[model samples]
Structures are given as C-alpha cells and as structure tokens.
Target chain A: MNELVHGALYGTLIATAILSTIAMGIWFERKFAGRMQQRLGPTIVGPAGLLQPFADIIKLLQKEDIVPRDADRGLFDLAPILAVVCSLGVAAVIPFSPSIIASDLDVGVLWVLGIGGLMVIPTFAAGWGSNNKFALLGAMRAIAQSVSYGVPLVLAVLVPVVLSGSLSISGIVAWQAQHHWFAVWPIVPGLPAFVIFFLAMLAESNRIPFDIPEAESELVAGITTEYTGAKFTLFYMAEYVHTLVGSALGAALFFGGWDGPFAPGLHWMVLKTLTLFVLIYWVRWSLLRFRADQLMRLCWTWLTPIGVALLLVSAAWVTFGGTN
Target chain B: MQSAWLSAFAFLLVSTLVGAGLLGAASVLRVRAKYDSPLKHNTYECGEEPAGMSWMQFHARYYVVALFFVLFDVEAAFFFPWATVLREEGTSAFIAAVTFAAVLMLGWLYAVRKEALEWQ
Candidate 1:
C-alpha cells in the first residue's frame, strides 16, 4: 500500500508539474513569438496571459469527443492514454533534486530511454487506430524520423554514461559535481556529443524544426488529425510532457541536474530544466523545419558519427585516467 | 576482448528479454478492434485518397542505406570502451583505434561515393 501510494504520488505530482510547465511553455512561446512578430500575444487572458493555458485546457476539455466511423474504437481510446502514460512515467526516474526523485533505479538512464520508446507505440497506434490516411502517414513519418534520431540520441547519451561510469542519472550528476562540467571540461580527444544530444533531443521530442510528423500545413495536424476533445487534449498534454521529459533528461545528463550554488536542490533542478526548455524554444523559433530526407541525413550522417566518436574518446580517457 | 564481448552479450540478452516481455504483456492484455471503410482504408493525403501504394518497390538505395547503417552501428558500439581508455593507451592505442576507425571509414567513404546513402 505504501509503495502504491508512493507510485500514485509520483505519477500525480510529476503529471501536474509537466502539465504546468507545458502550459507555461506555450504561454511563453506565444508571447515571445508575438514580440518577435511585433504583436501582442494573449495579453487579455489575465496579466500577460498567464492564465491562458488554463483557458485553453478548459476549452479543449469542453470540446466534443469525436471518433471516426469505422475506426478501431479500442485502440483509438488507448492511444492517447498510452502516450500520456509513457511521457509522464519518464519523470519517475528524473531526480528533481538531491533528495527528491520518484524512484532512483540503478539503471535510471536506460529505464528512461527504454520507456520513452514506448511513447512511440501509442503514436503508431494512434495513427493506425484512427482509420485516417493522414494519421497513418503521420504515424509512418514519426516512425522513420524517431528511429533515425533515436539511434544517435542514445549513442550520444552514452558519452556522459561513460564519463560518469554509471547509468544512474543521480550518479551522473554526482560525477559532474566532482568533475568539471562537460561544457567546460573537454572529454579527452574532444567530441561534441552534447551538441548531437541536443539536436537529437529536439528530433526525439518532435519539436519544431523536427516536427515533421505533425506538419500541420502539409498533413493537417498529421497523425492527430482525427482526434477531438479530451483525447486530443491528452495528445497535446503528451507532447508537452515529452518535451519536459526531454528537457529534463538533457539537464540531468549534460547541465548537471540540481547542481548549483545559490539555490536549494529542487530550485536548482527547476532552474536548469527551465533554462534548457527556454533554449529549446529559442532554437525552435529561430530555425525552420528540415525536409524529411534532410532530417534523416543529419541524424545518420552527422550526429551518429559524432556520437560514436564522443563515446569512444570518453571511454579511452576513462580507461587511461582511472575508471570511474 | 572476451570479457567485453561476454558482458555485452549478457547486457543484450537481459535487455531484450525484459523488453520483449513487456511488449508481449502490452499486446496480450490490450483490447483491439477492426475497422474497414473506403475512406479509412485509403492512404491519407490530406483526406484525399492516396494516389498509390505507400509501399512501392524502391530502387536499390534504401537497401544500400540499411546495409551501411548496420555496418557503422556495430563499429560505433565498439568505439565506446576504446574512448574510455584512449589517453592511457597512449600512442599504441591511438594508432590501433585510428586504424580500426580508418578501415570502417574507408567502407563508409566508399559507400558515400557510390551514392549508397542517398534515399529515394
């Protein structure tokens, strides 16, 4: 019962935090985009539109749920749930502070990465279950794009794992606390796994510039075209949750999660993750989407080699210097 | 070499079993339903029926690309441990690692020159 309560608390708190972050992210993006484009963004929704995401949530929830005729009803319902669950579950292993983590598995890094792959299952299911051609195509694009990026993303992540000599995320942060930051400390015969990791993360999260799966202009909301109301809202929530998880993972691995001088542990963690989130959005707005072929090429041709090199160099350095 | 290979094998076996088990459980317990309609069955091009089969026979390019990926992926896996030990190995390890990478790169460069990486 205690374990179950812990699990429930874990799920609820993380889900709520993710939803809030995503809400804020949307608000920030809109405001920032408007500023860039010389217009006001949602200023009417209660003081710089701080309450706009809530309004949007209410609106989305109030909308009618529509299931397409001849669609696989079961899977259609299951897809969004799966997406949300997987995305939210990623928070379980993420150490928000030195003291606060949902669970600190020995193989926390792999657990996060592996469960993240499960998020793809729902995406594929959503496309297939919807009985819509666009959704199917969108799903297919997701599969191709994710697989291409994911290979390098995991490879890139291994650089830190090698450096820290541990797959546990907390251990990685502890390693960072002991050593200089990767941004400063070059991993022996230097390789840019961090850059590759960032770019691959952008792709994995299906953010702008790599959001080919949901090319709204080209595919009409892509795989999610047919979803409506709460289901659609869940998908939106899942996307943001995925983004938060990705950003958190990036913070944990590269930026040294919850490691800072001035703030308390959770505060430091929140600050690091938020900074990464902002940076991702900044990059998103600054860049244009890549062509599907180009995205795949970038992953396979450039990132993979860099990731491989980074891992190799880090390993060699560790072997010589002294094992972690 | 033997220890490394054995460890990797063990890791692969354990992860695969766990992954397969979870995937199996998800599949077995999940309820599913079938759907069939002209609109639903057709390929989706913005709600318009698909022009052709999404799975047409491609040229030899995709195959070649897959081949290259397989080769490089395995080689990249070996690079991790080598990286941890690079400085210690000093000149000898560097030389051996360089040679190893160079041989793989040669194949990669050859494939790239042959336009094997090109898709579509």
Candidate 2:
C-alpha cells in the first residue's frame, strides 16, 4: 500500500513538473532563440515573458475550435489526445532520482522505446485525417523518418544495456554510478553511442534539422497543417513534453542519473536534463533543416551501420574485460 | 511490481482526463459569433478552394521502409535478453549474436543496393 501511494505521488509530481517545464521551455526557447537572432523575446507577457506559455495557452483556449469540413472528424479529434498521452507515458519509467521513479519496471529501457515508437502513430493519423495534401505529405515524410531513424535510436540505446547487462533503466544507472557514466566510462563505445543516440533522438522527436515533417517554409506546417485553436495547442504541448522527457531519459541513461558531485539527488538529474534541453533548442536555432534525402542517408548509411558496429564494439569491450 | 504499475496506470488515467478535459473546455470556452460560417470550416488549400479528398494513394516506398524497420526492430528485441547474460554466457553468446546480426545485415545491404532508402 505504501509503495502504491509512493508511485502515485511521484507520478503526479512528475506529470506536473513536465507540464510546467514545458511552459518554461517555451519561454526559454523563445528567449534563447531571440537572443541568438538579435531580438528580445516575450518581454510583454510577464517580466521577460516568464508567463508567456500560460498566456499563449489561455489565448488558444479562448479561440474557436475548428475542424475542417473535409477532415475525417473522428480521427482528427483522436490524434491530439494520442500525441499528449504517448509523450506523457514515458514518464512512468523515468528515474528522475534514486527514489523518484514511478514504475521501476525490469524492462524500463524497453518501455521507453515502446512508448516512443507510438509517437509516429499520432502524426500519421493527424496527416491522414486532416484530408489535406500537405498534411498527408507531411505524415508520409514523418513515417519514413520514424522508420529510418528508429533503427539507430534503438541500437544506440542498446549500447548501455549491452555493457551493463540490464534492461532496466535504474539498473543501467546503478551500473553507471559505479563506473561514473556510460558517456565517459567506456569512451570507446559510450562516447560514439551517445552521439548516435543524440542524432537519432533529434530526428525521432521532430527537432530542427530533422523537422522536415513539420517544415513551415516548405510543407506549410506539415502534419500540423490543418490543426488550429486548442488542438494545435495540444500538439505543440505534446512536442515540447516529448523533448523534455527525451532529455530526462537521455540524462538518466548516460549522464549518471541523480549521481553527481556534492551529493546525489534529483537536482543533478534536473540540471543535466535542462542542459540537454537547452542544447536541443541551441541546435535548432543554429542549423538549417536537412534535406529529406540527406536525413535518410545519414540515418541508414551512416548512423545505423555505425550504431550497430558500436554495439559490437561495446560487446567486445565487455567480453575482453576492457571496461571500467 | 503491481503497485508500481498501478501508479503508472493512475498517472495515465489522469493524463487522459487532462487531455480530454482540456479539449472539452476549449470547445466550450472558445469564442464564436453564435452563428455557423461555411468559410470557417473549409480545409486549408494555400488560400485556394479545397479540392478532392486529400487521403490518396502514396508511394510504395513507405511499405519497404516498414519492412526494414520490422526486420531490425524485432532483431533489436533479441539483443536485450542476450545482453543481460553476455557476462555469464561468454564468447559463445558474442559469436551467436554477431552471426545473427550479420545475417540480418545482408538484407540491410540489399536495401541499400536497391536504393530503397532514397527519400524521393
């Protein structure tokens, strides 16, 4: 009974944290991007626009909901719900700190992958249901990207699992805590595997440079082309939420979750997660989106093959006893 | 395990409520002229009148991509269990794993040779 209550409390706390962080993430990204582009961002909302996300949400909620007459109404409505749900699902397994996990599943790493894979479904549904050429086109691009990039993402994540011989995320972190972190412990595989993971993570989450699925200058908002008002807000919220969770998951897996100098705690996990979150936006504002062909080529020919090779190298490292 | 997932279930249920409730609230709270407008409901077509159904046949390429994804994704599942026991199973496990992946690599090679991954 106590365990159940602990899980529920932490689960709710984590959910609230994710939603609020997304609010600040919106403000932070805008401010960060604005500074990079030589302008002030959201200065009017509330003291440097700290409350901008709330303001945006309020404005969107008051706007008239519009579902196009041509759209498949049922699927259109279903997509946004699925989007937010899938993004929030991974939270259940993430160990923010040693004691801050919701479900410490034995196969926690696989849970992340399983939940992450469902993100593609919502994108496809939105595109098809919108009944717009651009929407469908965007969906197709997204599906292709998901398929290609998913391989490398899985293999890269697998590197840590292989070395530690544990599928549970908490297990991996325990292993890393003993060895510092997979990010540096076995640098031969850890460092390269982290690279592949980051690249694949960007693509999987539809972050910039890999955001062709929603490219405004080209696909005219892509899969989000037909959405408006509150539905659009939900989709936007979902994306940010996924990125934040992705940051947290990556930090836990490779950066020593809750393991840092000056004592171990949730603050360290938050710090590393925030650092990666900022890095995502930095990369977004700094680089141009990749050509679709270039993105595919990078994934299949480069990242995937290298990801598998690194997995082998990690195995060799473990087998030959060269690990820390 | 039961208790842990129970919390996860509670979390998911609450999130669903949050998602659905927000959507419901927005529809009720949103502004309208208390009138129906046809123009407001038309699909976006780059400022032009919308045409036929947008859901149509797409490239056969997406199918091939799905094929490849399934091949590797399933192979990936095998690795998790194999990894956890690699320490106990030793080099025999290593060789078996590599050979399994290498055989799958042949299909990957064929896909590349066929240019199945081309985005166009």
Which candidate gets the maximum TM-score versus the true structure? Answer: 2
Task: List A-chain TM-scores for all predictions.
Answer: 0.95, 0.97
Residue A105 error for model 1, in Å? 0.9
The sequence of per-residue lDDT tens digits that candidate 1 reaches over residues A68-105 is 76468898878877777677666767888886666666
TM-score of each: 0.79, 0.96
What part of the reference interface contacts, as a 0 to 1 fraction, does candidate 2 reproduce? 0.72
**Which residue ranges in model 1 land beyond 4 Å of their true spot?**
A1-4, A187-191, A322-324, B1-114
Model 1's alpha-carbon lDDT is 0.70
Docking class of 2: medium
Chain B alone, TM-score, model 1:
0.54
Q: How do the residues B7-84 of candidate 1 rate in per-residue lDDT, one tens digit apiece?
A: 223323332332333334434543344543445433345556546533333345545554554565466456545544
lDDT of 2 by residue, A204-317 (tens): 889999999999999999988888888898899888888899898889888888788886678899999999999999999999999888998898889988888999988888
Per-residue error (Å), model 2, residue A50: 1.6
Top candidate by DockQ: 2
lDDT at A28 for candidate 1?
Answer: 91
